[model samples]
Target: MLARMLVLRFPKEVVDKPIVTNLVRNYNLSFNILKAHIFPRKEGLMVMELRGNRKDYERGLKYLKDIGVKVESIGQGIRRDDEKCYQCGACTAVCPTGALHIERPEMEVVFESERCSACELCVKTCPARAMIVMFDKAVELEEELA
Candidate 1:
């Protein structure tokens, strides 16, 4: 199985269409929408995790592009700077995915990257500024796709 986080931008002309539904029915892909903002007759933006077989995934992406959806990979990921973290547990409170949590018995903050959804809540809630967003990969991928 192949899974990727994607940011999709829809032009105003295609904003009202059932783009996601088509992906599921026609492309045989599954998606988990992390965020979306769409208004009728206006441009739309969505952040989602799309999962499928490698071939089907590629086909789905092509379909999106053919329909005027600008698809971008969320090549970026979150990293924790242990040097900057004070283990104060401030980030744990806002982490919706349990990516940042205090370990039992030790009372130390642990960061589980696999569970992270790149929501950035830990980055915002951390008083010590420990959580960092890495953007280099995203920039490279965007440039290559463009």
Candidate 2:
């Protein structure tokens, strides 16, 4: 099955609080939260993952909107770029999902696309700028490749 995911970027203050807990309790939804760091900036980004039907996803989005979380962007499925990767492992260190892993034996790194929530932390942490989170339209184009 295709796992559906969404990335919502909120102000640092909003995410640093108990809002996430409230979201879980109030919406009755399960989510994996990731802290992302986009380029040209030092602050982190917040990505939320939701599972289940389209209706459920939509409901969660409505809840987010009501609460005034400014969503930076949203996408479905995993996003990564192998060509841009330099295997530095900085992205792996900061990945909340453990989606990116570095194997010491070969000094090789792997990106588990299935586990990625498109938080863009990898994108930010990669000094080489290899990782990225493709937005809506881009998501469609990449689906076939994925």
Q: Per-residue CA lDDT of candidate 1, range 90-145, in tens? A: 99998888988899999999999998887666877888998987765444433433
- Identify the candidate with maximal TM-score: 1
User: Which portions of model 1 miss their true places by more than 4 Å?
Assistant: 136-146
- The 0-to-1 C-alpha lDDT of every candidate, in the order given, reads 0.85, 0.62
lDDT for each residue of candidate 2 in 46-108, tens digit (9 for 90 to 100): 555666455655676687677666554455445667787777888889888888898779988
TM-score of each: 0.81, 0.54
Error of 2 at 40 (Å): 26
- Window of ten residues with lowest summed lDDT in model 2: 35-44
At residue 38, what lDDT does model 2 achieve? 35
